[model samples]
Structure formats: structure tokens, C-alpha cells
Target: MNEKRRFRQRLKDFDLTLPESKKEYNRMLFTPVAQVYSGITRVLSFGRDAAWKRKLISLLPEIPEPRILDLACGPGDLSFLLALRYPSARIEGIDLNTDMLDRAASNLARMPGNIQERIHFFPGDMNELPFNDGEFDIVSGGYALRNSPDLGRSLAEVHRMLKPGGYAAFLDFSRSSRKHTGRLQLGLLSFWGRLWGRVYHGNPEVYGYIAESLKSFPDQAEFLRLLEGFGFSPVHYLPRMFGMLRITVIRKN
Candidate 1:
């Protein structure tokens, strides 16, 4: 079979509730589209993806030579932004998909020597990061949490990776607790996402995964509770696009 057929078959067979399956599905979904991931994000978000990321970075407090971690750093957009905002900081980006990592690496190569030296990308899972406890001063994840195969485990890992008083910020689609409202949100997201997926990849399921994943993700309030339960204190919450998207900053306590 051809690549598109294989992708559709895998998407149909994979179960999002299973962590390993979700991880593998994500790899299959993104690998073929890594080159256009950023562009698609801009289109999907109505040209606000970059602005949302910039707002996320602005929420972070300045730290001198801080060590930063960008989890699920697809194409290293947030990682590069953090590097530019904090020139002396060392930024490490980790993602499950190697194709995305390759794109990030390619982007890094074109940068000047100083940024190229400070930023590095690697292949890894967020739920089981290969780093020491309290290793990072700041951790940022753009559209990361909602995509995690195991959100609680991933949040626990984020808590474990951060130093005391360190901050972590995440930008992602927000869900509502109310069933009807959530269904409306998911339906709209799925329709728009699948439209783009069909246009770009000739497969609606390619981007429809976003809505499917969000179906299992916690709503805003529950998300905040999860963060607090994982030893993080919510510091800033910025809702954009009528609460459909949010940038949340929390501090490690």
C-alpha cells in the first residue's frame, strides 16, 4: 500500500486510550507532515500560533542563564523562541517523533553559532524523560500536554524535572467540563482540523486526531487541579480565542 493508505489504516486501528498506541500513532501522524507542521499550525490557528507562543514566552519571568526544557518540541518553535528571549540560557528540546527532531535540528543548523550551540533537540517521551530530578529551571511545552499519551504521568515528569521555584508554561486547546459545550468544541475542532488535513495530506484523520485526543483531556479547571496535585502552583492563565486556546504558567513548589 502507499503511504497515505497506510497512515489511514494505522489511524483507524490505533486506540488513543492506550499510551503506547497513542505514542506510535502520533509518530505515524506527524512524520509525513513535519515539513509543513509550522505552516499548518499557523493556518489552523488563524495566524495566531506564533503570537500565542510569544505570549507564552512573555509570561515567563527572566532568569539568568537558566536551563530550559521544551517538551514535545515539534520543529522547535518554542525552543527557538526561548533561546532568543534568553540568550544565555541552555535550551534542550525533546520529542517522540524523530522526523520532527530532524526538522528542529535542520532549523538549528541555519542559526548563528551561539544559538546553534545552546539549543539541542533529542528523541524522547515526555512521560519518561531522561533527566535528573530538578534539572531544569524552566520548562515550556507548546501544544504538548493535550497530546501526551498519559497526561498525569507527563505532568508528574514535568514536576520531577523542574527545580524548586522554577516555572513551566503550556499552550494548548482548552476543553470545557460541560458535556454539551465540550462536544461543540470538539466537533468544531474536528471539522476544521480534518478540512486542513484533507487539504494538506489527503487524509482527514491526520488532523482529526487533535479533537480525538482532546476528548480524553481534562478541562481547564481539572487541568489546574492536576497541576496543583503534581506540586505545581498556577501562576498565570491566559485564555485566547474565546477560551478555546489557553496559555497556562505554573511554578514548581
Candidate 2:
């Protein structure tokens, strides 16, 4: 059997599920290749992924001596960006995956002395962050919520960590509320994801996980409600790639 078919068969045989599927695929994405994840992400998003991140960064409200946390910060892409832009900010990046953190540390090693001191990474869970309540001035995560096993619990942790009036922003894959439009966009994304996997990853089924995760994740409006229920006010969002991706900015009130 071809590798793609075999991959599908294995998932079928094991009866793998949504968040589980997401978890497995994410591990695979990071396992075989850690550094290339960002490159492939930018490519698959048609080069607009960085733009979405920039939008999220721009939404960050000015706060005195901001203490920032980048949750599920895969390879510290956004975290690095934060360090570059906010020299005075203390940035802590947390993720469950050690290899990603290792790579993040390596990247941090290359920076000048002050930046290296300001940005750091450690192992932590987003659902139960280790810090005390109201620890951060801003919390930003890229593409983490969609993969979160419990979005409500994760958002709660985010809210708990932020000082009142702190901002939390995230960039992630988003979908249309309309079923047909959602389907079409996901189809195109899945096709591209699989193609990237086949060409660069030698595992076409790996990136197909994107489509599956999107289908299982909350839509734009639903997620906005989730933020509000979590006690995040002044919630706002921006879409890019014609709604293929989004940046949601929320603040604790």
C-alpha cells in the first residue's frame, strides 16, 4: 500500500479521534522536522501567516514593563518576534513539547545579550499554567487554541494568568460560519497541506490533519462567544488569506 493509504488505515484501525488525531499529527509535524514547521506554515498559508502574526502583535495594548507569555509557542516564532519588538518586555514561552523548546533555546542563543536575557522557554501546560494568578501583562499564543483539548479550560487559564486589563492575542486557522464556504476553503487548504507533506515531508497524510482539526474546531463566531464567556472583553479579530486564517485579540476586564 502507498504510505498515505497506510496512514489512513492505521488511523482507522486504531480508531483515532479528533483531539487525539490533532495531537498525533502535531507530534509528527514536530518530530521528523522541528525547524521546518515555520517554513511550511508560511508556505501553506500562502505567505500570509506572518502578516496574521503581525496583526496580532499590533493589537497588543501598551502596558508598563509588559510581562508576556507565549503559550504553545511552537519553535518560538511569535515569541521571537515579541522579543525583537519589545526589548524591555520580559517574554516567557511555554510549550508541552521539549524538542520545540530546545529549538527555541537554540534560536534564542543567537540573539544579542539583552534579548537573550529577556526571552526564555520552559516546559508548561496551557490548561494549568504553573504561574500564580495575574502573572502576565500580555498572553499570546499562535495556533494553540484549536488544538487545545478543552478550549474553555485553556481560555480560563489564560484569563487567570493575565492581570486585569491585560491582553491575550492569538493567530490561528479560522473558518466561515457558512457551511459551503467553510467546506470549500478547508478543501483547498487540505489539498495544499497534503501536497506539502507529499513533497517535503514524504508523508502526505500528516498535513491532512489540518482539515480534520479545522472541521472539529469552533467557528469564528463560536470562538468569539468563548472568549466573552471567559471574561475577555473588547474582543476583536482580523482575518487574512480571505478568512483562511485569523488573529483574535481579547482583553481582561
Candidate 3:
């Protein structure tokens, strides 16, 4: 099979949609190379990813001990940060990738014991989360929303998992008005992702598929409406890094 066909097959196998679910994405697509690929992508972003997540956390709703859910919590960065940000709150990290979950668990384990106690990482499918209805005060995704098998379904799932009046933060790539910057950033990202995937014995198909997926991702207005359709009110978005990425926040009514 060709690269596209293979990637499509993998996506179908894992139930990933256009934005591309890293969790359902092939284990061979990552594996031991997961850490290396993450490192390379972080370097390519000039270390902006974590800072962006931090900023999003800072903007979270002012609730005492909000229960936060990190969907597709690859490597547990957002979940770990939330744990530290709200030490008294409950935080859960869920991903479909067992290997990635293992890595997340390992990273969490190395943290100071107290911090580790505040966070939990488990395998979860975004389309049908395990938690009961209205269990979380906040639900967040880091670059995971795009790959959801059904964006609307995923949003509904997040909404259902949140308590009434709960809020959510979804950060992912976007088609920025600054076309030149977006193109350059994407080109550099593709090059490094593919190169390093090969270097670390990862699936190069994933890199190419990501480029294609980004090209086909929904624009800001469409995404906002999707959130609104899921009963999210007070929806807002902040385009970041010259519009190459964006973070959308929606409050559940």
C-alpha cells in the first residue's frame, strides 16, 4: 500500500479522524521513539508548547479545586502541570496509547511523591470516556481534538463528562491568516518530524499524515460552532504563534 493508504488504514483501525488521534494512531507509529519525536517537535516549536499549555491553565475557570480531565494526555505534560497548578484538585490523564500511557505514568512517577499523588493517567477512548456524567469541572485536550474520530462526538463526550458550568480548553493547529508563517512552520515541522521518525525507528507515515490532516483541519469559525452545538456557551478562541495554532475555551451551560 502507498503512504496515504497505509495511513488511512491505520486511522480507520484506530478510529482516528482528520485532526488525527495520536492515541489511536499506531504504536509502531511511535513506540520507544515517542520520547524522541516529542523532543524533536518541542525543539522545533522552540520550546513553546509547554508554555502555551501553562498559559491555558492560567486562564482556566476560577473554581476551588476544579476536577480537570486531560484527554489524549500523551506523556502527561498537561495533566502533570494541572496537578501542580491545582494541587488540591483531582486531575486525570487519559489516552488510548498504552505505550504513551506507560511513558506518562513513568514521568509522573518521577515527580515529587506529593505531586504524583494528585494526578492519574489511564487508557481511555475520547469518544466514550469511562467517567460518569458531569464528573469533571474541566476537560482539556492538547493537540488531541483534531484527530478525534468525530469532533462533535468528542466535544459532546467532553461536555457530558463535565459538571454543569464546567469549562474546556482545546489547543491544536490552525490555518492562520499569516499564510507565510504557517507554511514555513509547517514545512519545518514536516521535515523534522519525518526525519526524526526515521531516526528513532518510528513510522514516517504518521508525519506525512499529520501534514495532510493539518491541511484539512477545520477553521476557527467552524470549530467554534461545533462547540456551540454541543451546548458549550461563552466560547472563545485565541490564535497563537502567528496563527499557526489556536486554543479554544468553551463553558458548559
Candidate 4:
């Protein structure tokens, strides 16, 4: 089997089951391979992902300088962007991947000294975030939501972290296989991802994971329902590229 399929089978065989302990889950999913795969893609993807991230970050309110939390901030790109955009905002980059946190710290250290102060990096578990209630004005994640073992539980944690009127903006692939729309888009994404994968790292695992995960994802409507069940209101989703990608924004009451 191809590397991607192998990884999928591994996840499926385990049912993508995370350990009851957050620490163990972190050790498994955030392995060295995952970190390298993510870090390289940040560059190999020609930086288009930043634009998607920017779109998500733009959803926050402007009245007060908001404290932002970036979940699974591999390599710290999103955290850095938030700090750059809202210079006065308090920003934290939290992830299970220590390697990614290390890279993020290196990235931050390399920045001009002034920009480094606005960002904080820490090893964190999304299922059980280590922050107080109603702490963040905005919480965002990129390509990270779908990887959660329990999407609903992850969303619940996000909700618990936000203060009333705070916003949660997230991006992830949605299962689009229902219509010809989803399949065509998935095929194109798979082709490009695999091509890039081979050229950059020759490990098809990354591309294959994208395809398999999207195939296994909940439909957009179901995802919306999940969000609502978490007590988020004003839920809105923008389906990109014929539903292959999605950005969801919801506000906590």
C-alpha cells in the first residue's frame, strides 16, 4: 500500500483513537514526520495557505484589542500573523507537537526583536485546553480541526475558551463526496497535493491523508449542526473551491 493509505489504515485501525491522556495523544499524532510534513508544506504550498489564514483572522471584532489563541499552530505561522496584524493583541500558539513549537520558537526568535514579544508558544492539547474560562477573544485553527479525534469535543473546548461575543474561526476540509462537486474537487486537490508531496519530500503520506480524511469527514451541514449543538450562534461557513475547503465562523453567546 502507498504511504498515505498505510497511514489512513493505521488511523482507521485505531479508529484514530486518541489516548485518554492528552500527553499520549500528543506523542503519537505530533510525531517528527507530522511536524516536518507541516513545516515543509508551509513553504512548498507557495504561501497560499496564509491567505486562507488571513481570511479567518479577519473575522475578529476591532473595538477592544483581543486576546487570540491559535490551536495546533504548527510552525507558528498563524500566531505570527495574528501578532503582526494586531500588534497590541495578546497571542498564543498552542499545539501538541513539541517539534512544531520548537520550530515556532525559532521562527519567532528570528523575527525582529520587537515582533517576538507579542507571541507565546506552548505545548497544549486541544481536547483539554489549559486555559481559564472565557479567556480568548478569538480562537482559530488551520487544517487542524478535522484531525481532532472528536470534532464535537474539540469544538466544545473551543467554545469553553471563548468569552461571550468572542469568535471562533476555523478552516478544514469538509467531506464533499456526496455531490459530483466534492469528488471532482477532491481529485484535483489530491493530484496537486501528491505531486507537490513527491517533488518536495517524496512522501505521499501527506497528500493521501488529505484525500482520505476529506472522504471520511462529516458533511458541511452536519458540521454546522455540530457547531450549533456546541452553543455557537451566528454560524457561517464559506465553502471554497466547490466545497473541497471550508472556513467556519461562529460566535459564542
Candidate 5:
């Protein structure tokens, strides 16, 4: 086998590099190569990532005016959009990656006073959110849930942090339940992920964790059950990108 093939084989056997934890995952992708995350999102979402984010933002209750929490708000892509959509709402974000938070702050600082004033970020853990109980009206996570180290507790924290009738809207990958289709999807995504990673970061494995992580992510039905078990009532979700991704909108009981 060629050197590149051998290298990947070795990595497959031992690297096990994945954003699957509180510390290891936090430190894995926030390197310089992570600058391409937004672009990769755009391409993979068919230039509709922004629109999808907007849609996720819309899933929240807007009338009473929300105290918004954007968990794992990397680079503020969705947070910034939330600010534009809810100029007066209080939008706070918490993340573990300082580099991503720096980027998020820089982007937030560029907005007009009306928007910039309402958005902020800090270091936090999903299993133990820094906020008090029932502290928010709407909680939105952009591609954050699946990456969580503890999905149960991460969601439990969401339930704890939101007021009764509060909404939780999130976007993330959805592993197809159909075994054959999932394999095909994973193959295509792996090829595309490696290509994008190599072209943008000079590291073919930069985004390979996406495919690896999806392999273990719960299928949609199971995920919905998990959310329900957490007492998030009236849960609803919509698949995006031909079911490659999904948006869940659930209300705290």
C-alpha cells in the first residue's frame, strides 16, 4: 500500500481522535485547522447552514421575548443570527474551546450596538451548566448535542436551565436507522469530509471525526425517546439535508 493509505490505516487502528469528551474533544479541533469549520458547514449544508440556523432560531417562542442561551456557541454563527433576529433578547453563550470563544467574541463585537450588547460568551460544561435553574426562555444548540460527552446529563441540564414551557431547539447529525443506507451515507460523507479537510487544512483527518462520531450517535427515534425521558414534553424534530441532519424542538415540562 502507498504511504498515505498506510498512514490512514494506522490512524484508523490507533488514532481514535474524536471530539467525544469534555477535555480531549475540546482540545482536539480548536486548533488552527478549525478555522475551516464554518466553510465545511456551508458546503455540506448546501449553503443553507445559515438558513438552517435561522430556522432553528425560529423554533423558539418569540412573543414573550426570550432570555436565550446558545450552548457550545462556537464562533457565534447561530448566536449572531439570533441577535439579528431578536435584537432586544438577552443572548448568552458558553463553550469550552477558548479559541472558538475568541472568534465568537470577535464576531459579536463587530455587530451594531443593539446586537453586540445582547450577546456574550463564557467557558462552561454541559453536564454542569453554570446558570441557575429555569434561567432561560429558549435554549438553542447548533450542532452541539451530538458532540456532548454526556448526552443524558447535557440534556438534563437543559431541562434544568429552562423555565416550564421553555423551548429547546437544537441542530445535529442523525445516524440513519437503515443499516445499508447509513453505511453508504457514511462512505460519501467520509470521502467528502476528507477532501474538504485536506483542501482547507492540509489534514485529511481534520474532519474525519464527524463520520466516526455519527457511527455511535443514536438514531433519531432513540434520540427522541432520550429527550422524552428527560421530561422534555411535546418534542418535535425535523430532518434537514435529506435526513443527514435533524433539528429537535422540545419543551420543558
Candidate 6:
């Protein structure tokens, strides 16, 4: 089969609602677009991608000699940012996508030795992390939660990996509370994603997964409740781009 047909078949065969299927689907979906993911994200967000990420990093509280994990750390943007923000901190990034990890490695090589020494990127899944319990001071992910095959399990892992009072910050597309508004946001995102997907990859479905994923994601209230259930307390909540995107910071109790 051709590239497009193969991708379509993968999309058809995998059901996003199932945890394992979503994991496999994401691997297939991201491999082809990993190289252009960062650039395309900037375009799709109308140049707000970097600013949103910077804000997510800024929301994190200060910690002395912190150990940080950037989950779903595609291209290591958040990881590198965390290193810069906390020079004394040790940063590790984990992602399931090997192609994205290669891109992150390339990005890491261009940094100065001091920064390079403090940051590491590896292959791992959020639902099943390899770290010890209470191993990190802070955890951050950009556009992370929505992509999780199992959101609650991933949040549980984050809570498990964080020390008492440690913070977990996430930036992702949010579903609005109002039904009409939610539908509008989904439509806009789907159109924008597909437009860029076709432009860059010659397949509209390449990025259309964003809206599909968001459909199953909980809105702000339910999201906060999930955090509470996982023994996290909300620290800060900021909505951006008319509530289509949100940055949430929570502390593990």
C-alpha cells in the first residue's frame, strides 16, 4: 500500500478509545510527522506554541537542585526549557516515539556542554514509567495529557513519580464547558489540523487525530476532579486562546 493508504488502514484498525490501541495508533501517527512536528505546531497555533510552553515552565515553583521529568517530551522543547530555567536541576525526558526521541537527541546535541550534560531523553510510556515512586521534584508535559492512551493511568503515574508537594504541570488543548463552544472549538481545531497536515504530509488525517482525541478528553471541571482523585491539588489554572488551550499546575499531596 501507499503511505496514505497504509496510514488510513492503521487509523481504521486502531480504536482510540482503547488504551493499547491508542498507544499503537499514536506510534504509527507520529512516526511520519516527527521531523516537522515542532514547526507545524507553531504554525497551527499561530505562533503561540512556544509562548504557551514557556508559560507552562514559568508556572512551575522553584526547587533547589530539582530532578525533573518532561513526559511526552517531543523534540525535548520542555526538557531543554526546564534545564535553562533551573540550571542546577537534572532533567530527563521520556516519550514513546523513537523518531521523536531522535529529533530530541539532535536538538540536545546543539546545546552547550553544561546544558547538554544535565538533560537526557529516552524512550518510555507515561502509563508505565520505569522510575521509582516519588523519584522526581517536578513533572511537565506540553500537549501531553490529551495524547495519553489512558489519561487517568498516566496521571496516576505522574502522582506516583512525584515527591510529596512536588508539582506536575500540563499544557494541552482543553474542552470547553458549554456544549456549543466545545463543538466550535473541535471543528476549528479539526479544520486547522487537517489543513496543515495536508500541506506538510499530503494526508489530512495525519493531524485530524487531535480533534478525535479531544472528543474523549474531559473538560476543565472533570479534569480538576481527576487530579483531585489522584491526590493532587490545583495550584494554578490558566486558559489561553479562548479556552481552547489550558495550562494546569497541580501539586502531589
Candidate 1 versus the native: TM-score? Answer: 0.97
- Model 2, range 1-253, lDDT digits (tens) per residue? 9965666566444323444554555554555456577788878877877877877887776676789999988788899788766778999998777788888888888878998888889987787788899999999999888767567788999999999988998888889988899999899878988898788767766677677678878887887877888899856788888898888888898
Which regions of candidate 2 are displaced past 4 Å? 1-25
lDDT of 6: 0.91
In model 3, where is the ten-residue run with the lowest total lDDT? 15-24
Please give the CA lDDT of all the candidate structures.
0.91, 0.80, 0.74, 0.73, 0.77, 0.91
On TM-score, the stronger of 2 and 4 is: 2
The C-alpha stretches of model 6 lying farther than 4 A from their native spots are none
lDDT per residue for candidate 5 within 1-253, as digits (tens), equals: 8765554454455333333433454454655535666777888677998888888777766645679899888888888887777767898898878788888888788888888778889877777787899999888898788767777778889999999899888988786778887788788778877887677666677566677777777887788788889998755688887787888899988
Clashing pairs in 2: none
Worst 10 residues of 6 by lDDT: 3-12
After superposing candidate 5 on the true structure, give the runs of residues whose Cα lies further than 4 Å from its correct spot: 1-22
In model 5, the Cα lDDT at residue 44 comes to 69
lDDT of 4 at 79: 83
Report RMSD (Å) for each prediction in the order shown: 1.0, 2.5, 4.1, 3.7, 3.6, 0.9
Q: TM-score each candidate.
A: 0.97, 0.90, 0.82, 0.82, 0.88, 0.98
- Which should have the higher TM-score, number 3 or number 6? 6
